[model samples]
Target: MEEQLQATPICGRHRALNALMAPFGGWDMPIQYEGIIAEHSWCRSSSALFDICHMGEFIFQGDFVADGLEDVFTFSVQTIPLGRSRYGFLLNERGGIVDDLIVFRLAEDKVMIVVNAATAPKDFAVIKERLTGGSFTDITAATGKLDLQGPLSRYVMVEVFGEEVATLPYFRFITLNILGVEAIVSRTGYTGELGYEIFIPADKVGELWDLLLEDERVKPAGLGARDVLRLEVGYSLYGSDIDEETTPLEAGLEGFVNFETTFVGKEALLRQKEQGPPRQKVAFEVNGRRSPRHFYDICSGGENVGMVTSGVFSPMVGKGIGIGFVLPELAVVGTPLTICHERITMEATVCELPFFKDGSVRG
Candidate 1:
């Protein structure tokens, strides 16, 4: 049976704007408003607003060590300073990733966990089960999130929110009063630009959205543009690029896993490390403008050696780019490969991770 998709509080507003709505993560979400290309251009040259309220948020209050939270993730949570956040993974017993999340260190004994929307329920259960003392609470329904991204995002944020928001460094955030409610303004985003992710009360999202759009430099963008922006920067999408069967090492994200600490899958990861990964993650660039979509076969020497997991026609580069898992020998840079679907085949070459090099993420 097909489950009915739920709608967010801003669903009506999105419909009024004639945005394209599609089912994603069990919710009817906006994929685009005016157009994906227009929104993508707007985000690159100016600023774009995104409704990110569907993401999950959790607050944990207890001893980082005693509550078993320190050993929950692959990284050490105690090392993160207040007002700073760190990105890491939550792994299953077999060293496979359950989900990748960001932990914001709010205080010495308090932390906020931001997770992907679709995995919210499962992530909550898994995290709570691992904890022995922390008072953990889910605040997804009570909170709303909006991301303002682009090269000009700082100017718009400084005008509406405050100059303090403009001064926030990367991976850091500050609490501010917005629409008579407390919100977290973080200088972090999925887009490869200078952006801010604002978390406000669920009801106040509309007001904030309207206020930002009032500025000439900002436009409303949807998930379609967001996807392109993230992919260009080589950031991995959860379900597409990684899953429960993919380990961090196999996904080309070994830097995020800290082996000094003991986590659930440490032993498995250690064993795999000694024996090397079976399939290695690879990034490729197509010779033409045609896009290579998901589940496409990657062939080398007339043999199916891998599968493309995420791919797109990069508007910025005017070419197709993709990421996939291939045999170690075929994962070398500049290696020639072929991406094939039902009747579509494209010539591609394995290259570096980021298809787009120039970005304003640090600026």
Candidate 2:
């Protein structure tokens, strides 16, 4: 049997609200406070707050080029301006992704890396071993993160956080006083909506949560709704869609990898680029409301072709949609496929990503 999971500081609050609790990455996190669809709709129509404290954070203070940090990720860290962040991946020698992360250039000599919870420890170890200069520290325990997402997220944030947040452009962050502690508000989120991710001191996180809940326009959402939102937008979940065994090129994330710089996985990526990828990532939409799920088989012409990595019943599209890896030839748009599982199968068609195209993500 699996060991009992630990709970967050807001576990009592979630329990008081009758939230559905489940173990995720060793934490007893709230799956849903109300219903998944209801919370998802609320986020799309109004504003929703998400407790993202389960994610991990790290701080590295050193020369970007000399400390070997510049070449650690797929993107160049030295070119990133202070108070701005860029998303990329850390890869193994074989070009397989170790972890997908966002690096915030706090200063010329300081940077912060935000990574997924499930890959946190492995990411730390891999990053540290590759460093040749500067000191690195895991600041996850000292940091807490929250995401407020939706079309109305901007208005709601300006009302609660401050007017300064209104000026933040995409991928930019500003340090502000929140709950009597310095917090960083970044115009970034997983959901393809206008959103902000607030990073505050851990001790003050609960207070910030309560204050946000006090707003009539804001409702507390959970990971269940978050999953649906991200899937609908075609954003890849770290462990589910990409893993250590998966290369970014095959995962449909080659844009994040920069070959102009020297990195650990450059040689392998160059080789893969010269020789076509073995498999390619593809997105599809179901014909009906029945949703595909992880590990579901993708079949074409009565033959198994691929495997679903992440899927959900899309609230925005009012249909089922999924992303999976399949043979390169079968990844064309309009290709008919079948999603198969134990005693169940559904008809689907290969389609473009972002099942819901009408979003305020850039606005």
Candidate 3:
């Protein structure tokens, strides 16, 4: 039997706007408000508000080393300074990625861990099993998250919130008063835009959503648009791009892993590094507007070499773009490949990542 889908705090607002609803990560999420392409374009040019309350949040308050929290993830937790966040992964014994997450260092001994909605329960279990002592608690039920992203996001945030938000550098966060409560505003986002991820009390999220949308410069965008934006910037989608069977080296994300640190999967990763990964992730551009879809075969010299994991018709690039795992020899840039699904075949060329490069993410 299929599990019952969960709903976010601003679900009613999405329905009132007549959004196209669909299931995503066990949540009944709005797939699109206007349309995927339209919303995608709007987000690239202006600001787009997103209901991200479906993600999970956890609070860990204790000694990083004594509590055994320091060795749980790929990156060292002690290195992250206060008021800043770092993105990395938790891995299984086989060196496969369990989840890609961000850890916010709220204080010397306190950190907030934000993870994917679908992997929250398992992630908590795994982390808990590894910890010796720490006050670890799941805070997802009490927290609501919303993302404001795009080139004009800074302007809109300053107008709606205040000038203090304007000075926040990338990857930094601040706790500020919003809707009569303390909220965390982080300069972090999935989309390749200058944006902020706001975490407020669940009950006050609806009010904050309304207030943000009240601005003329801000428009509500759903997951459909968010996917396109992230894909254009070559960001990986957890379930599709990386999973328990996939390693960071194969996914071209070895930079996130620190071999110097002792973690659960470090030994396997070191062995894999010495042996080299069998498969490698590749970015490609389709010859035309025919977008590659997940599970589609990646062919080279009429032989199946891999499968597409994520693909989209990008408005910014004016072509179809995709990322997939392919044979190491065939993953080179400028190598011609064929994406095939049943009788349909699309011509493509192996390319470098970030298909759309002129994004306002750093600006």
Candidate 4:
């Protein structure tokens, strides 16, 4: 028998909105509200709200060094100033990425670790085993997260939350009061838009969600739209793009890793740095509107070279864009490639990332 999937506090609300539901990360999540394309467009032009309660949240309170937390990830924890967050990866002993996550420093001796939903349990276990001393606790069940994204998201947040949210820079967060309860509002998002992530008590999330949608400019977007928005910005999905067998170096994400840091996979990364990765990640664009799908073959001169990890027909780009792994020589810009499935085939060219530019993320 299959395990029962979890539901968020706003599941009833999503159903009321006639959302398309599907299983994601062991949870029954909303795949779309009105339609994927419409919602995706709303997020790029106006504002789109997303229910992000399925993701994981953890809290750690204690000595950063004595608890061995300083060396658990690729970047140092002690260096993160208050009200700021840093993105990096947790790697295995072989230098393969375990999970890409963000660390938020809440106070002098307290921090919050946010991770992908599917890997939450394993991430918690791995982190616990690494820490010699710390007050670590998984707060996923009690915590609720919602994301508001798009070019006008900042205006929406300021109107609903407060003016304080208007000035919050990217990757920064602040503790504020909402609905008579303390909450964390972070200027971070996955949609490659000017956005805010609001964290509040699980019971109060539904209320917040309802209040935010009161604005005429804000519409609810589901995971389907979220996936497209993230892909357009070249953000890698944890399980598909980078997994236990993929390293940051090969994924074109080495900038997130600090070579001077003493982390669990330092030696292996050093070795790989000297030896070079066998396969490297590449971004490509199809010649036409034909979309590439996962596991599709990537060929060069009729020779199988790689496989597509993520692909989509981008509304913003007006073409198909994909990310995949291939031989290092074939990962260069302008390189010709053929994407093939059982019968369908399309010509493509290697390209730089962020297939859809002109995002208001930094504005």
Candidate 5:
């Protein structure tokens, strides 16, 4: 039997705008509006709004250390200062990533854990089971999220939400009243641009969305554009670039892990660190405009070494770029590779991350 796809608070708005809808992470989501490339370009040059309510949110209001919340993620939640957010992975017993998530320290004893939509159920169960005590509640149904991203997003935000959001540093947040309700505005985003994530009540989301789009500066962007924008900055997509079977070490995300603190996957990661990972993540650029695709073989010396997990023709870079797993020896920059699938083959080279570096992410 086919599963019923869920709808976000902005579903009607998306359909009214004639967006291309598709099932993503169990939700009926907009894949693109006018077009993928057009939306992507818009986000690079101006402000782009995204419906992020499909993602999950949870509230953890209790002791960070005594309640066992500190040991839940790769990073320590107790160390995060109030009004700041931190990104890290939730790992399993074998050091494999359960999910890549962000923890927002709303107060001394309260946090909001945001996770990818597909892994929310599993992540919630895992986290609850690991905790010895704490009041952890799934707040996904009650919350709505919208991401406004681009170089011009800050100006648009200030004009609409007031000047209080103007001085928010990256990874920091401020609670502000909007439309008669408190909304958490965080200076963080998936797009490699200056952006803000607004979390409001589900009932008020449509009003907020309408309010944002009323300004000519903001246009609605979809998941398709979102994927390309993230890839240009080398952000890993949960199901594609990393998963429960992929560890942070092999995914090139070990820096987010704190070995000083004990977590569920600490011991296994320690062993892997000592032994070195057998395979490593590699970022590569295609020599031409041909795009590599997921599950395409990555070859070296005429032998299959690994497979491409995420790949797309990058308009900003004017070429194809991809991230794949390869034998550790071939993960070095400047190494030549061939991406092959059936009759399609393209030449690629292991390159550094951030395929497009001139972003307004810090501006």
Candidate 6:
């Protein structure tokens, strides 16, 4: 039997636009409207709106120390200042990443956790089991999330929301009024651009979506463009780049893992830190515009060394960019590599992250 797919509150709006719809993370989502490349290009220069309400949201209110909330993730939750959000991993006992999530410090005793759609149930279960005491509840069904991303995102957000959004600062959030409801607006996004993520009641999502589209500068972009945008910046995709079998150390996300803070998988991570991760994530660029896709073989010295995880032909870079795990020695920048799948093969070179660097993310 086929599984039922969930729909966001803005699903009708997407259908009305005659968007190309498909299943993504167990939800019926729009893959594109005008087109993938066009939307991707628009987001790079202007702004693109994404319906992200399918993501999971959880509310936890309790003592950070006494309730074991402080040690649940790779980062220290108790130390996150109010109005700020911290990104980190939820790991398993073997030091593998269960999910990469963000914890928003909503109040002194309350925090909101945002997680990927497909991994939400498992992430919530692991968090609940790890905690000895806390008022934790899933709020995904009642909450809605929209990501307005790109160079012009900040300007659009300020114009629609208010002047308070103008200086929200990266990683910080402000509670503001929108459509007669309280919404949490955060200066954070996955596109490696200056952007905002708006969290509001599920019922009001369509109104906000419509309201934002009223601006000629804002257009709806689907998952296809989102994938391209994220890959161009070398951001890791949850299931594709990092999963329960991949650790943060191997994924080049050690900076997010606080060694000073003891948490689940700390011992294993310590062991790997001393012994070194057997394989490391590498960012590479193809010699031309031919795209490398997921599961493509990464070759070196006439042997398959790794497999492509997240990949795409980036319009911004005018070439194919991809991230994959390879032998530690082959992860070095400037190393020559070959990406192959079936009859297609392309020469590539190990490169540093953020394949496109001129983004207005800091602006």
Candidate 6: where is the Cα deviation over 4 Å? none
Q: Count residue pairs with overlapping backbones in model 5.
A: 0
Error of 6 at 82 (Å): 0.5
RMSD of candidates 1 onward, in order = 0.9, 1.0, 0.7, 0.7, 0.6, 0.7
Q: Could you tell me how far off, in angstroms, the CA of residue 304 lies in candidate 3 after the best superposition?
A: 0.6
TM-score per model over all chains:
0.99, 0.98, 0.99, 0.99, 0.99, 0.99
lDDT value for model 5: 0.95
Ten residues in sequence with the least summed lDDT for candidate 6: 354-363
C-alpha positional error of residue 30 in candidate 4 after TM-score superposition, expressed in Å: 0.1
**1-363 per-residue lDDT for model 1 (tens digits):** 988887777888899999999988778889999999899889989999998888899999999999999999999998999999999999999999999999999999999999998899999999999999979999998888999999999999999988888678999999999889998999999989889999898899889988998999999998998998888888999999998999999999999999998798888899989999899999999999999888999998889999999898999979999999999888899999999988899999999968888788898
What's the residue-level lDDT of 342 in candidate 2?
Answer: 88
Candidate 6 total steric clashes: 0
- Candidate 6 pairs with clashing backbones: none
Position 209, candidate 2: lDDT: 88
lDDT of 6 by residue, 1-363 (tens): 998999999899999999999999999999999999999988989999999999999999999899998989999999999999999999999999999999999999999999999999999999999999979999999999999998999889989999999988899999999899999999999888899999999999999999999999999999999999989888899999999999999999999999999899999999999999999999999999999999999999889999999889989899999999999999999999999999999999999999999887778
Global fold similarity of model 2 (TM-score) = 0.98
The candidate 1 region of ten consecutive residues with least summed lDDT is: 2-11
Q: Worst lDDT window (10 residues) for model 3?
A: 155-164
Runs in model 4 deviating more than 4 A are none
**Which stretches of model 1 miss by more than 4 angstroms?**
none
Ten consecutive residues with minimal summed lDDT in candidate 2?
Answer: 2-11
Could you give candidate 5's per-residue lDDT for residues 2-33 as a string of tens digits?
A: 98999998899999999999999999999999
lDDT of 2 by residue, 35-121 (tens): 999999988888899988888899999888988998899999999998999999999999999999999988889999999987888
lDDT of each: 0.92, 0.91, 0.94, 0.95, 0.95, 0.95
Candidate 5 vs. true structure, TM-score: 0.99
